[model samples]
Target chain A: MTYQSRYAWSVLFRLFHWAFALSIVTLVVTGLYVNSPWTNTVLEGSRSFPMATMRYLHFLAGFIFASAVAVRLYLWLFGNRQEKFWDSAPITPRNIRNLFSTMAYYTYLTDRHETRLGHNALAGTVYLATIVLTLIQLVSGFYMLYPESVFWQKWGVALFETQQQARFIHHLLMWYFIIFAFFHLYIVIWNDIKSPEGLISSIFCGRKFHRSSS
Target chain B: MTRHLDKSHFEPKLSRRGFIKGCTIAAAALGLSDEMVPRLVEAAASAQKPPVLWLHFQECTGCTEALLRASHPDVGRLILDMISLDYHETVMAPSGNQAEKSFKDTLEKYSGKFICVVEGAVPTKDGGIYCKIGGRTALEIIREAAPKAAAVIAIGTCASYGGVQAASPNPTGAKGAGDVLGMPVVNIPGCPPNPIAFLGTLLHFLTFKRLPELDQIGRPLFAYGRKNHDQCERRAHFDEGRFVEQFGDSNHMKGYCLYKVGCKGPETFANCPAVRFNDVDVWPVSAGHGCVGCTEPNFWDTHSPFYERLPGVKIPGTGGIVHDVDSAGKKILGIAAAAAGIHAAVGIGKRIVKGRGKSDEDV
Candidate 1:
């Protein structure tokens, strides 16, 4: 029953986590609004660009989201061993075994919970997928924003061939993020409830209390 | 029944002043600098007019009809007489073997000199038997004529990207001239392209002795450079989110954006808004209809449901699992929400059964 506090998330990681989360939430809201603005209510007696303003805000949030993701990527490449990119690699035989075990635990096929200081194999794999999807979103968003720019016109046209296809992909991928966010929140909350060793607080306070094996 | 062109008889019909005016207008339309006007005039006035061989395939001859209906006085006349116009099946006063003889004679007489203006999609299925002229399939005629010409111009959507004939389940296996010729073809693609586009392209070549700059699809950049949405008069409505939800609604009458009603202007690349069709200040958008993205490749098949914003994505191998993007997205969100709700209910039930009382640590 003995418990020990261990440093987990870094200060920078915590900041990035919030920034990324906030930006993504903002982007989803504004992006959906841009796709189909819900209001025809023009400001009475005043000439204002509501849709344009929404678009600008959306674009700005997109840049912030992209930058946060970039910073996380940099940390994954150059940070401590515990935070290294390989920590999220789901391909190794050991990681694969852990992934299945984690899947089994979540599905209630197994009662044993394998305790880990970092993200479990299944979570790490999902994060990897998120990173890839974020990259696609960034590229597609920027390309659509400045399709006629010289470099993008040449390379982007070669890549996407048309703006409609790029738009379709961008819109479709937003749903993926939405679905992922739901599952992510549920898992995090469920895990914290199951093991009350500062599971949720670790992200905020950079430390987690784990039950000592002894 | 072949009719000989009496250049002397036709020369007097177009005044030097009218011809020069047409050239200037054409030069401007072609996106050439004002300085290019003199060159255009010279090109037009030159004794040796550029020969043109007009070819028709699987088409409705709408493009020719549009050209004939040019609003500017003498524009139609200039288009017809300014070029040698060696052969045009629609306008030519010849038929049967005489027409065939005229086409052959013109092709040989102006080899490596004439411009090949193809006006329709070339059918390739069943050896292009769907469309034939003078015992030759469109494929055979294009193959023979395109390579020998100094330049090739695909005058309408059909000639550019197979148009309506190439729509889904295209039985005729119709294709554009560029696909058939296996060479770059200057494409001026509209359902029935603005005749001015064709005129400008022709004038540009005649004036400069080379084709104008083109976009990825071989469409003259001047005409297809900016998107239709960019120059649309109703763009302010789009920006303000004042859209026509349906045809003939109050907003539509107020000239609101047609986006919600399936205007493809955003995706369509053309100068339709800038240079209104038939020289009138009205385009499809102005006339209260959404652009069908007629200038784009595969418009008929890809840009369908002209009243919808986004086209449905057809699932492969499925008989018909075409999903509208907006609805599909909403469904996914609904499913995710439901799943989260179910999982939360299950978790709460488990917690209640286990007697693990809710603690402040749950936050």
Candidate 2:
């Protein structure tokens, strides 16, 4: 069996990916602490605002995460074919069929599997959904952060109606990301181990090994 | 009725000195500059007393009680004298036909000149039959009166956000005054909103001849400008994470932050801490109880289970099985872990089977 090394991801895509991941991880940790600070460490004589500091960090990371996601969205719309928006389109009949086949392979109901570059149909669908969820998180977060601001008070309150609802949605979606991360990590590792694709390394090096022969 | 009585002759129950002192204190409480003290006093003493028609609907009359229990001994009298207080069902000596006559007379006497103070939620279900005043539904009376008034103030959580009456399965379809009147209304929302907030708003309006600045919910910004947590006395404890685990525990006795025991101060926007209730140095948190978030909309339904850190999310159509954030998160995480474990097992099994098949072919 012969294999070809192909360029799969852009440098910008890798940078954004890592930045988004780091920011999200930091956000989740600090966000949870902000919600219910379980730590009781009192740095006596320091007079530092621990909760406030955590909140500021959370907000800072939130901005970074939002910007990275926005860049990723822009790249999706106008980047090269390998990184274009259509790569994640899961609406076509062929894509739907491919999704079911992919599910079957995962479930061990199929022996043979289709070969593809970039994301498979199911992964594409999940990524699209993730983009939507990230957008929701960003809107809700900014709304809660500046509920008193005139712009948010006028528009965000109209859309979300209350800060409590926005907080609820934001917190709930954090769990979704957590669960998604678990499966995402497992699948990437499993694919790398099961195939000669270097799936995990591809994210870092922007290159993947693909079978040259049909 | 001495309708044209001068400020000196008004409300003998409140002496001029007491009224002036109260006005100065109220001016300070309202976040007005010290220079505004004279203006507040002048506004209070003005002969053209703005008529206030206080309306009652589906309510507990707690707001009126709170006002009566104001810290200043003469505050009630001062408020009554400052505003004409043409009609209030709770305090008025008249009842039955006489009260109705008084309300009607006042409405006619001060048409487009009076301030409308609504103290309860307005029911819209079943022709607003839930609350009736003088054989007239709340909706009907508000519709007839609200448009005629120069300014309308909803003076409690009930009047602001439908309060407890508009909780889940709200049978009467109760709504806030703003929603029912289809106009912006100044809302001073609390289970029993601080009397100073009401007084401050009314005084600002009287002094400026315009409504004070309001938030999105039409609450005066001076009083409802900051979060309760922002101004909480125990916020330092919150920052240090010294939380009360349970009511009457050691932490509670130590006067730590009540966040763990379900204090809604962090999310609730109010000035309860800055201006303690009854002008005494005591509010809910200071009195060793978590804030129930009485000022926010639909608080009764949304900010309940007062002992929990966060309100439970009710899954729609689940017949009220509420899941708190942690539990729901844990469930998802548990499922994800289980799924990952099972997948790992399946992947290992597949790999072994493929390896054996390859070895057999090689043999």
Candidate 3:
């Protein structure tokens, strides 16, 4: 058998990935602080505005995060076959079968893991869920940010009964992102080690290794 | 000019200057410009007093008490004079059959001309037996009277969205007046709503012959449009993170923000900080306590664990067990971490077992 290397990710896809990750990290850190500000500044009164600064950063990062999501969504619709939603996501019947097969590999029911050029069905399914969650965050975050906007209030905020409930959903979803990060890191690293593919580096560089018949 | 005014219902001490001053305040509260003050004065002096039928149900009468305590326009007296309060159970001199006769007479005589002011929730469970007045259930009375009135005003949180009585496990199945009547009503919502808001709404109605612009929840925009946090005196402190850690803390004494001590000001929509209560330049936050968020819907359930910053979230699959988001987030994260660890361990174990005897061909 010979090893073949394929260029998998577009430059925009890699940029979106890193930007999305960084924004989520900043948002989670700043969001947690905004929820409960533990840092106390020595400067009193109008001299320093810690919460205001934190909230501004959160809102700023939120916009960047939303923009990153928008880029990914655009890619899902119009990018390469590997990057497209219908091709990558486990939506079609063929992909559904691939999902069960991938699940079998993860659960140890199958010894030989099926290698795919793009995302395996299970990973794609999880990515789909994360995309959905990011959308929820964007909607809720925007609603909370612009409380007085008639459009947001009428449409976005109306979905969540109150501003507080919208805030609560946004906060709760942050935990999901955190947990996803933990599992995502572990699984990608595990796959990199277990398989011949340089799975972790593939995200940074656009290349993945696959086995070919000699 | 004021000689015919009933001495009991109109403040005798109110000079022409005071009346104009009251009208100016009314104009301001109604979100009307200075140009409208003269019109307000004219309406106050000459507009035909709209007949009002005030009903009581499952409430504390705090709304009435707050109205009575209104001093800016002497709103207590002003309301009595500006509207022919034909049947208020609290202040009406009559009782028993006479009060019933008055409610009925107003219902018949004025019909679509009279305004209905409901001050409490109506119990809908078991034939509305939780509260009764003159052998009629609150549900029955509101159902009968609301359809006939020109407009219905729900005067407190109880009447607006069922307040405390409709909190979790609401035994009486108490619902707001709008819910009972199955129609929209102008909601002036607060634990005990600022009487100025109620008076402003009434004056705006009397002046314009229509209800003021209402919010998505049918609350008059002048009073319920802006959030308490936005209008709060401690907003600067909140932005600066100068929070009171607890009651009677040094920060509390300094009148810092009450967000940390479970102030629901951020979510509560009301003009409490701006309009104030009892004619004093003070509100819950200004008086050194966090806002209870009495103005919003289902506040008792949604805003409770009042001393805490956020309401407890019911854990999924815990059969309605609720925990604050912090601890719940931690627990969920921990579980996810543990699950990931176990899954990684199993993957590692499988890989090791495979590597022991097999050629790495499967890889």
User: Which candidate wins on DockQ?
Assistant: 3
Q: For residue B210, what is the lDDT in candidate 1?
A: 90
Top candidate (lDDT):
3
User: Which lDDT tens digits does candidate 2 get at residues B1-363?
Assistant: 342233543445788788887787678778878888999998889999998899999899999999986766566667888888778988888888888888898889889999999999999999899898777899999999999999999999999989998998899999999999999999999989988888888898999999889988888998887879889999888776677777887777888888878888877878899888764667999999999889989777667776765678777898888888878888879988898899889867876877745421121
Off-target runs (Cα >4 Å) in candidate 3 are B1-15, B316-320, B356-363
Model 3 chain A poorest ten-residue lDDT run: A37-46
Please, what are the lDDT tens digits per residue for candidate 2 over residues A94-179? Answer: 67887888888777676556667777788888888998999988888988788667776675567666666667778889988888
lDDT of 3 at B34: 99
lDDT of 2 at B270: 88
Model 3 residue pairs with clashes: none
Error of 1 at B75 (Å): 2.7
Off by over 4 Å in 2: A42-50, A91-101, A109-114, B1-12, B315-318, B344-363
Q: Write the per-residue lDDT of candidate 1 for residues A6-50, one digit (tens) a residue.
A: 887887788888888888888989988877777774333347666
Report fnat for all candidates as fractions from 0 to 1.
Answer: 0.32, 0.39, 0.41
**Against the true chain A, what TM-score does chain A of candidate 1 give?**
0.93
For candidate 3, give the docking quality class from DockQ: medium
Regions of model 1 farther than 4 Å from truth = A1-4, A42-45, A197-199, A210-214, B1-12, B106-109, B313-318, B321-323, B344-363
How would you encode candidate 3's per-residue C-alpha lDDT over A1-214 as one tens digit per residue? 6779988889999989998999999999999988887865524744888899999999888988998999999999988778989876888997898899888877767756666778988889999999998998888888778766677777564778677777778888998999899888988876776676778888999898877756
Lowest summed lDDT window (length 10), candidate 3 chain B: B1-10
Error of 2 at B200 (Å): 1.5
Query: What lDDT score is found at residue A66 in candidate 2?
Result: 90
Tell the DockQ for candidate 1.
0.38
